[model samples]
Target: MFKKLLFCSTLPLALVCGSCSSLYKVDKKTYVIEVNNQNETFNNLSKVSGVYEPRKTLHDTLTGNYLLRYKYKNETKYDYLNNYFYKNGVSAKFLKFGIIDEIHLVDAQNSTHIFNTDEDSQINNVSDFIHPDINRGYKNPIYQIQTNNHNSINSSFFNQKLASSKLIRFKIKNNIYWYNKDKKTDILINSKDIEKSIEKANLSSQQTNELKAFGIEKMDFKANENNSYFEIKLNGNFKAELFLDLIINNKIFSAYSDKFNYSEYYLVKNDLKHTLYKSVNNANDIQSVLIKYNAAGKVDKPTHAKHLLNEYHQGLVSSNLLDDFSDVQQKQLIRDFNSNKGIKLSVVQNFSNNIVNTIMFKDFIDEPDKNNIFEIMMYGKNKDKNSQISQFYSQNNIDFRNNITQIINKYTLNFIANKTNYYDNFISPNAIISNAQNTNYLKVIDANDHVSKGQINLAKNIEFYPQDLKKNYYNAESFLNVEKQLKSIHFESISKNLSNIIDDFYKENSNLKNKKINFILPLKLESLDTRIIEKLNKIFNEINQNLQVNIVDINSEIAKKYYNFSNYSTNNTIEYINKLLLTSNNNLINALTNSNVSQYKILNKTKQLLNKFIEQNKITVNLNDKQFLEKMSEFSIKLHNKFSYFEIIKLINEIKLLYSLPYNLSSNIDLDSFKYELIQPWIIKPTREDNLIYFEDIKMEGKNE
Candidate 1:
């Protein structure tokens, strides 16, 4: 019995919990509430109990109007009314009551207050309160109201006359027309107008072809009274949308008209081909015009107009002084134009092009072939400061100075020793030999270790000397010859080092991939003695098959000969000779070991054996040729002087000094910086000769003459 009583109590509690957990559905009903100007009546259109809440009043700042906020409740619980008035000349009061939205507006006199509300299903009913004449369709009522007010404000400000009937304004180029929206009339842009505009544009053939491809010939404009919009018709294989986009975004079909006027404001094209807007009225009113243009989508932003006008005025002033300005003044103007942060980079680039063209043209008119424009602009006075070329380089972010310094540092030896014409004057073996004779020859001295008053003779007298004296002289002569050979080997080792460095530079530096450095030896290969030629050919052939070292006639026109030392090795000749002697069929060892013969006979037999060995091995060089010996001696001295470390370092220091200056041909500017086609005429052409060696060779080595 106790268990049954407990079950009964638990069943009641469970029943209560189940009832609490079950959801109760309530039907929601939307109410359209309207408040009149006097705020007197609260008519309950829907007979709901306690639906209205206490109202909170607010004031509008524009027309001193009043708004009310209310809270209420439905079956689903809480509901609120949100209402507020815009604080502007065009006042709008918005109210959200329950599930309904409403808009209230008053005229300028505050005499009438209009209120309209829409249910959640028909939300567009409230827009009727803002403007009853125009059908806003799907657009926001607030935006339409603001646009109408803005149009009115602009019309009043600019003194524009409006017709009594609603009219649509169309602006094409500088021509403006008005059409009645309600009336049906023939308004069209014919093919003749398009043809005339195209003709007036003076478009290029490419532009004409582009237009033709766009179906410009089939394009026509006509007014659509039903839709109240202008219709653009294209009949050919063209997309109307794409044509419209091109017309709107690009200057392809632009009319040549540069000046546009509306009431007191006018947009005029400046000398820089930039359009600038101004007002014939008060200057302070220009900002208002810009604002109006911005609102109408005529301008992007008001601040952009100010920037454009600033640039346009600067361009105008500079253009006026083009003819009368001196070179100094023009240069100063270019500097000023570039330094102005307010100016756009594109505008600055255009100004640089103009200034450079003017200066170069004037310079050419005054003098040609004497003063390169690059020299006048880069190396002239006041070059340290910014100029047209400097501005162009800076804008492109090209560090010519750094690039040139790197190239110079890498190829210092080539710059000093690689000029063909300068080789005859700067690198003479005779001068070096004469100087060495004067400084190194033995001088006669008295007992006190001072020079004697008698002249010292240099001729050898070994023919009349005794056998011991002759043997000593011969040993001394052999020692001197060995010393000379050692010197020659030392020079060849230095040349090898230089060649390796050059090869590495060529492989590593990508900037020099297309560049070539020519080393034109003064001696003609064809004019050299046959034995010397053969030895040179053997040396060239045995080093490597890379053909790095080349022997051509001095007058031959070999294109782009970069100094290459890959076909050279210090021991190439010696190794070749050793190989030839070891593998040859001649009896060279027997000739050397012949103790039965006299010394002269041994020497003669050794020469014959060497000649026979050379023949057998197909070696072309002769060891006993007088002309060959003289030519080889001259070449040895020339090579020694050419690879002198002291001379190379001196030239490197001079190059460093030249590059360290504020301006030079390589470090200052280049034609690559000026991308404009109009400036191409002023660009100096590089000669094949100048490109072989860096142009600085002509300047520094005095080879320009």
Candidate 2:
């Protein structure tokens, strides 16, 4: 069976009743954010006829806010207040009507925050407190409901139900075993002995009595028509649900406090063969004793597993930066949890260019305190170029939001501008219009193509038509230039608006310095031809004459590195050698083809290798061949077709030696010294020569001397 099991943790907290005021004094700037309100907490709140605050309460004298903290009966119980104004940086009543029954998040006149709920009446004050600029969550929230109702639960009911009844499912298999809670000998049980196993299993007197009365239903051990194995189901009574512990053979398997169920049994599947189940007592205990831990918050280079994310987005692999999850870690986590093997944090941050863009994670196992909140601390060179680090706490901190906006804006602008820069500088039809290829042809055609108007009457005004045509050509060019100017203006406008928004955001909170705009320019290389190379040489010669242009013959490089006769021919070694000198049919007619069939195959492989290199390197071929550039074009193409790797290297060295001499042979003041200083250093001379053939003991003259 191919099944994808998703493990999710429902965070549960206690529901304490809070009294409401009759005359609600709604402050304009105050906003209320709600969390974890779909379980029994909402149910309990709906049942209450009157607003009732519990007797015991803690009042913050400084902030005029009351915090109702639940005393945890045990370690698993959560103690955070059911309702309290999360502390504001300033001692102001930012949450005026703190977490009311019909919560409305108000802000001055433009009240943008609204919490969606099941009951039309369920909505009042609760809102999601994400960064105002981040319109969507990093990943959308996925809800897996058992029933078809698919209703959004209210705050109080969700909180209470989640605390008591949460279910975790695991798949079991035949011959599967587990180590005990105390790490003793392996305990194995069959489907028939399951009830007897529970009876003899480790449990307190109260738990034994509870299990006996609840009674383990005789399991359907006979595999279904599909031939799948049995599943384990946990059934907890109301009180047992709070401190429910699964003890197998004096070993605690699993425990849950906030685990509750509307139905009696929560099912676990035997999804795989040879699966092992865990008999651990506490979740925290399992983590510490079993898990091979990777510590949190260490910045290091992380490895990524490949995933085909989307079909629509296709670009150069180097161009697209992705924030992807590690499928290896995720699969490992799932396998461990299902096999009763323990689980660990497999958190990964995906980034490009040293900027952390996305973070993916599994669920948390810990309960929370009032102080429990997500905090991201960023430290780098600030806008002022000062060495400093800044801490941004969630809620009541606008500095964090401003900084986040800056990062998003800067990155997005750079992405758009990079593409535009490529088009404007090189690819666009109108780019470098003065150097356009077809302009001379257009002028020649205009001069030659003329109409004889001797038959036309003088009064017909034919000259006006010619004038109109000329005016239209100039107008179109002007229009294109205007369009380019407008695009440039639009980019400037967008950048200015972004800066203004950032400035206005920090106006009230002026502790932050303005961010510096950093533009990343892509490293670009132009297509090579003889003319371009000569022009580059002239520029280099003026600046530093020692530089020389070298073109490596990729085909020869491939042949030299890797060539075997067996790779191309299935014939015997003797036959392959004989075929090298034999004549080939008309099929071998390409530029690099020759009379020999075996040699042609080798040459074809070399050509294929060179083409692959060209694609990967993003090399474009120059095709702007004017009359003056015809020689350069023919020479470049000829070298590509005729020369092997070593032959081209030899040609370049020969040209360097020839160029080293002055225009007049006798003009050099000291020929030997000039060769040592200017000529020999540029030449890669062979160590020894035999019968005009050079060997590879190449050395530069200046370095060796």
Candidate 3:
């Protein structure tokens, strides 16, 4: 038997090995699988297959066919685990593997010999190879096949491979198929390279199974409810912790988080079953420990243990500045890293802990873009005194302290609406742990204040002018414009008039004409979206978010719908839009026919309204026959509502400058002075239902006025 095992290693080929020497591997030079996008090949640099370095295998081991398996996405097949329950109380999904009769019939002419082992057979009794339901205690041949992807007698074969995702370790089993989900990748480990790996690891075969004990790789850290102990995946723990320690130690822990040099002091009890002593190392030999870790599986007896010290003083070599927020799991990100330079990271607020800490890259950023944003947070015991500095770290000068700081502190003087104006909207958010500026925050040394209280409100209503200035003014170009028109406005006319009226009598002799006037204009507009209003009107019996007349999305949809057919014409689109708006009729036919109020119920209603408008001479749109009937379409209220919300805000901002005092000022004033009177006008674009004043054709009596 031992001689046979020796032959299996010396000669290898694609041969399936069963329990009693049925499978044999034939040597055929060497095979190399092309790992796309990865420089490392599966050439067995590490000996013990299944997360085990190949070199760790026993030289005197039995020879047999070794099935190299790898699963990049380690999905749990717990649903098939006999009595699987969920994280909650949900029943597990259908099983992926089950027993099938030998020569199972899939159909009349197609017969397949099932080699799958039923876990239920083991659960019931390891000796029971079959179920009592079949001829030989196996499942009946499932004839009614819905899908042939899987191989179960009753459609139970796993269509996907079950290689564990995340690195894992497991001893090669005799005759069993490991199942995995369809979302991961698999790689075959090479035996020859593994022998070299074992030599490189420099360990006897006694500890070969140490890694294999960790059967599966799990990412989530789980704790025993008894509070006795906690189990952490070696790979999972290092990825998250090191990524955070980078800021503290001023080290970039993108890829080098795994297997750091730390001395393992195992205490052996002198007394048979009595006491064991524990000792401490105050980092005097921390460098030595680091060297040992660095040389793990690579160096000699005691020398490898000391190499970590050499690594420490050598200083950081190179780094890849990752994004502040990435869309990848930190572990996977690190796993994907060929070099440890910058890493994608994110520090978020934990409301429960009342602290802001770095959330794992996996939890926050999924596909973390290469963004170099870094933030320094200073935690304080007092919730009110906590502060944080967000630095948009740039890749250009990240190695340089000066350049990195520039990216972090730089904020362009751009304007945001009231909702996004972090300075003015509520203090940092209730959800955020801290939102303050942390300048050169010495957090590590300040242990007690390692946690910040809250983000600071550095500049609310940041001003361009001083309060004591005699004639200071700020242009309100960035303010909101009414939704009615897509033009900018300056509302200072009415505001200046009011200001002068007040100054004339209030401070006539005081020479207060140059006194700066602190003023803001508020436009009182009616609620739009009566349908939405009707809904909310029924629900709360009051107006809520319905007042917004922005139709950005709807307008785009309207534009896009016609762009494919009519090249996105406003005029052509409007006609279809009008039909859509006139939900009560067949507006297409109404536009097509000059007949006054005739035909179908929908057609009659539209014509009746148009005829009434024509009799009243309120119809300004010259809807001739040629332009009337283009096959029309309408949008659902829900879709239209979405369009209105965004478009209205744009309209408001654009029209604000156009309708301001300069357009119809009571008196002449400089453009600079005129800019400050009232912020700007706000346009309101209400639908027919939203605007009670709107009916029939849109009539602008005040367009030239």
Candidate 4:
């Protein structure tokens, strides 16, 4: 839902009684705009009878001339209407229609909600005006009819059947809010402060709302008599199907209303933008120009020239600012400008810069609605001790769709839109979301205080007592850490958090019977703390309880995994280590080697580390692991052979250091466990037990076992 709702109690009202006037005519400016009709995109029209508003209604509202207000309820003629206007860019009507919207009558449009039937989904709209929806009672039983027939209030037929084979399958994201009205507030996260960083966004909430805010069923934004609430385009048709409902005793109705707001939207350039920092912009229309500059080149640096973004630029992320003119000037032109003091607003904005980017360059996003003004990314050049903006092109808003398409084409060459929806990973999306307090990525979380008598230990690090965890800090640090470690090391993200993992673990194995087992994790944010707030609110219902989620901090996950490893690995240590080290090898698809990409990568990394450690420590050792031993034997032969590639040995050592494997595997030993089972596969000592020999790290601990 729209967090900032504009309720118009003093709004203009109209009545729709299943009839309306024609919706097309010349306005006062003689600028003809096709008004709302029935069928898709919502309308506030008074009536909808399939065809476009009849000419009869048009004459009734006109001053003896065709008026535009008289509209229809059909979207079929929208295209023809646009062509008739022939306006520049887009027609007047199209411009007004920004967000998509819709309206639904409990019993009129689809009475299924009134029946409360599992098969038919019955629902009853309250006719009373003094109370909320729940207090209202369902009208006396209406007649049930076979097939697609509807029953009125007077009908009392029972056991009548209705066929729902033709019903639309609406994708409802927040079931708690949809079914249970009381839990509605559960969705809205009311936090005045929020981190503005794309990299740190919890996308789970956003994806859920996306599924709810839209539907495949074609509806209209009612016009005129339709006290319009929303305008949704059904399959991109904006001409007809626009409808709004009249608030009859606070109930949504289609018979009377004037205007409607919609949740649907057009593709605007206000979504996201990430560009080189070097391209400084002194743009009056900073938003749009940023779009254009970013489009022209795959990279931008402050060293080139100032950038100018038009008003169309909604959300923008400036990653770097280079002082080199060549960086911004392309293959030609070297004029540029930038504020040496840096963009003040960005620094004071209370924003979320990519922790990585921040780590790369310490910065933060500004809080919105404050002294927060966006940095001016301009388009200008300096010469003769004077600076000048590019006069060749007039000011324009950045067309995000066009620029994104262009950026993708230029970078990817022959790119296809995949699940990632990005041209390349050159720019991280996480940084974009987190940098701006993106409402799209907002989530609603629930937290409760604990009063356990048990001892608990809480600290920044996990080296504390476990019992004190009942009041754990939502383990936010773990989530942050998970994201950090994932992007930095895995080059990927943990798509789902530990909560989902627990469910999946049980479902897959079907043997675990644990309950009330909570996980504590850390969420790494520079602010040091992030609160659990809700996004879209849900109406909490006591009797009808739903799956209450506790977003355990990623740290809790790490902690759980850390603590549980002993028990889990006790049963399957070798398999677990092999899986952990060989993750990349398993990633290889359809290859001759069963080895995963991670396996090869870890192996190479291990090689680098081992070699560096040996050289730095001035110690030498040999491993009898099949791959390690073979590589060592090859390295020995390379020194004396005339035509030897070596293909192993010291090269493997070089690979080890690069990976940063544990310096002393023995440190991970389970101090309490008597068995040597805790650390194997990955922690064996250099030994004479295999084909190779060692001169470092002394005797092996497990040889006797």
Candidate 5:
């Protein structure tokens, strides 16, 4: 019985030992266990742990190495182990026993660490260790770890090797950053590097040409020691300040490289056709910048006018259009428009010079107020002559019914009337406004006002003056009266001159009375005054019925030759030669006789002679050099000497004789007939006696008989 008991006990003990050995078997596979924690001390402990657990007990007891991948807001840690402990494994009892706050599995083959935390415990003081190779990877863990702060591990971080490489570094606002990499680096960017990059940049032909035109090749760029700022040395006429703003504001540097990306800095380019502006912020880490360039062929009259109108309508008060206008004038225009008082426009069309003058007034029907009026004159190419009015209308968009008070043709009498009105009211007209003599209109208005002040004296050209007016009744009547009076005077003078000429012809050739007498007159027969023509016809009938007269214009070639030859023989050869010879100076007479100088030149020569005489004689004077010279000038003379007076009288007589000869010789012709009767002067008359007394007396006598 004792032997049987021993055998049974030994068999049971052997079976129990076999089962325990199998349950405690160790996992030899490596594992990468990740854990996350927000606690600062835990993160610090992980960082200090390196290849081992931070706590001494854990480091002594754990089986793997530990590493803090990176420390950020929430800490992430990686624990690598070659050997993993299962829930029922021999090392699992240490974690469950909770002797330490955290447990790590240490791989004896690789010496890597994997973290395992015990519930309701903390890590105490631990020693630091060497950092492990973060590039290593591992298999799945025996027991999967779960934590609240864990994230998806970056495959690149584990796969890629950590090595230093070349990178471009730049600073914006004194903050340095890597160009190829998002993180900061010690590599700094200098101006030379930027210049090289720009040189090697892939720029379009247009962009390159623009830069060349801007004189970029003449510019030298240098950076500060820290490369926080850049200084550009300008050469030639290159404007550094302007270019800095242009390049930075237009983001032109971005065309050089793709790595340039700064969030706080940017550029904008604005092209408004007439003007261009580029804006940049924090250029070269310095101040912000703005650049402007005005385009060519801009701000012309029509364009400027259009801009002014648009700006005015948009409530803008100041513009280049108002530059010439005073503040008061501008205010008047603005006030009238704003208050709906209305503006008046008068367009004077000048077809002769192909110009249109636009006059603006403060109000419609307002009297000529120069202060409230402004004028704009438009000139254009000949081809665009007819488009001026259209352009004005298009630019201004004025209301014709309300704004157009009058449209005056510059050549018409109405323009003269308007000008006179302005003058009469003591208002100075604009430069574009011109004055003219409208005799008919002036006569009526002046007569109504009982003022003889408006008559224009044009006695020099009586035939051309007081132009006939057929449309105006009052003007036609007045014109007829003037025509009759002028014709009567001319008729009497012409009749007397013609009668004397014919009488002389008869007296000289009495035997040729039967021959037809042909009288060639140097005047336009058709244009001669009517009264003179009628009187001449009467005289010819009374003198000789067969007499015939032929009229030729004095300006005609034939008439001009005849008159010139006659004057040369009668006046030039006789009177002029005699006068020249009579002069005291032999040099003057010789000069006049031989020189080819004109009459004007002769006058100049005479002045020089007089000056020489004065200089030679040393004439008495109490004056400075300037005053003496001025006194010697022809314009300074107030009185004429006896010889000068005689010469002037002779010249006047000669001119009158030459000018009036043609009209006097050829006055027997009519041009235009008067359409209205002349007004006779008012004459006083005696009071008429009543004829009823004689009628009554004859009736009574007849009844009594």
Candidate 6:
């Protein structure tokens, strides 16, 4: 018997062989097969016969049919003498060796065969032939069927390819969109390009629907998420621009926080490049473009305006600057006037209409416009007292009369009412007593130091003013005194007003502990004068007692610690000790390692050293000679025992370097002292709450009158 391995290296190997006289020469090929194995195609197996008999013995084997056998290496096992035995399993078949030779299955077609090798089918027992599961396991028909099933599963599992989406990039030439090196031309737009890609791109579903109610068209591309391509099959060709919008996951693309760059997609029409225009909506969505189609700038204004009006009517866009007539509304004012000659007259007519509707003096019940009131007050003050204001009105063919009470209400009381808001809201909130001059009319300082022109003060008893009335005369010294007196009264008024607001705020919140109130008054020593301190004390005392608000004075405590160190007291020494323990770990350990102290020296002072280190008082204990040696001994043990022997030696060397510095802090302290204090064995108790105001200073500038 002769065994020869035949591998497919090149197609149709040379038929000549030296051992042609050998009988039963089996041709074997190597195949390694297991679960989920990758199969490779044999390129040289194209020339072979149809079939061969596996058990057929032949002389002159060069002319005999080719027998195909697959061999795989199996795990080794040892026998009784402890000798190793190498085994190989084989699946052999004699088949037609030729190009594209298909196998014929002759088994029970309904039954499937699975290869199962038993452990007892050893080479040593092969001659015994007691077990039929190995050599005589199945018939030739069943073997053919199993081989066919194996080949099919291996081909399907190892050779299958998956499908994926292809990216198609295009560029526009003139108005045509071209793909693939200009070999293909395609129309990329639908009628909904503007409605979907631009207008409805940023609009919410409800907003889009609302615009749709007004005959606006919108296309949603979300239905094509699973489709490989947006196949635009145009029946009859019409001109389509190469305009594109980003479609992600078949939805119109959006990036909320970043600026979406669409500049690359804009096409140049004429001399200008046209990009998608963005109009911000009520929902703050940037609707990309408003026009349904791309149009140049020649008539863009009118077209855009019309679209804007449409969007506005549907409540998609609001706050158009021309919603009410103003001078800044461009030439839109001309659109309202029917005749060119009455254009100026129309302006005056609109003004008069607004005045007639808005200005009313009788009853003086409702709030008057303070800005208009201030204007009227200034206008009335600048007018002549000898002639009537109606003279010019009659000359201009305008029949208008200013009511006496309305003039007084608008120009005086109403003007002051406007000023009162500024004083109450801004000045009172910040505790500011203003000294700025109001030079339009006779400036008067009231008893409360509230400064306004006498012409505008309705509370003043002055019924009328002279047209030539100049500012009230005053000597510098008396003016200064009165100003000072008025300033004090003004501060008092502001304080009272603030108190009232605070009281009201507390009441309105259902008296929930107003956690929002935090007042930290940082002051210096120079500002701590008697009067200012008293005033501040009174204010804060009232706030703390009534409002249930307490402001911490951490600065004063720090200041006291610094300025009065003799009387100063704090638990910060322990904090410092704890920090030293953690932060000085490396250096302290090194110092102890190198020190010449004995183990007993360190242990003896462990407790005493820790107590002294973290003492709140600044007193330092004087260590006796014996105590010092004991502390050093304790220090050496505490550090030396904790680490490895090599680490201890290294720490000792590092400690030697540390002691060479200007000061040796750890020279007297034991390691146990550092360990105890550093770990922070004590807890800090909270301080009792009290109604004491701590501050450095409170200066009352330019003393109160």
The prediction achieving the highest lDDT against the true structure is 5
Write down the lDDT of every candidate, Cα atoms only. Answer: 0.23, 0.21, 0.20, 0.19, 0.25, 0.21
- Candidate 3: misplaced stretches above 4 Å? 1-171, 175-199, 202-454, 457-705
Query: Taking the tens digit of each residue's C-alpha lDDT, what string does model 2 give over 238-321?
Result: 222111111110111211112221111111211211111121222211111001111121122232112111100110010011
Q: How accurate is candidate 6 locally (lDDT)?
A: 0.21
lDDT of 2: 0.21
User: What is the overall TM-score of model 4 with all chains considered together?
Assistant: 0.17
Off by over 4 Å in 2: 1-143, 146-705
TM-score: which candidate is best? 1
Over the stretch 241-263, how does candidate 6's per-residue lDDT look in tens digits?
A: 10010121112221111112111
Q: What is the TM-score of each candidate against the true structure?
A: 0.19, 0.15, 0.14, 0.17, 0.18, 0.14
Task: Give the distance in Å from residue 545's predicted Cα in candidate 4 to where it truly belongs.
Answer: 54
Cα deviation at 277, candidate 6, in Å, is 22
Residue-wise lDDT of candidate 5 within 1-705, one digit each (tens)?
332222112110111112333332111110111011112222122111112111222111121111111110101112214332121211000111111112122222433232233221221101111112223321111111222311111112211111111111122223333233223345544444445444654454534433443334433444565434222222232332223223322222321223432222222222321111111221221111121212232333443334444333322211122332445555665466445453321111111111112112111111212221111111111224223333222212121111111111111222122222111110111111111111221111222111111111112211211122112313444344433322322333334433454455456546555655443335344444666445444433443344454445555764442233121111111123222223222112233223222322324344455456457647433233433333332211211211232332232222221112122221111111111110001101111110000000010111111
* Alpha carbon lDDT at 503, candidate 3: 42
lDDT value, residue 308 of candidate 1: 29
* Candidate 2 TM-score versus the reference: 0.15
Q: What is the lDDT of residue 670 in candidate 6?
A: 12
For candidate 3, write residues 376-444 as lDDT tens digits: 111111222111101111111111221111111011111111111111110111221110111211111
lDDT for position 509 in model 5: 48
Q: How accurate is candidate 1 locally (lDDT)?
A: 0.23
Better of 1 and 4 by lDDT: 1
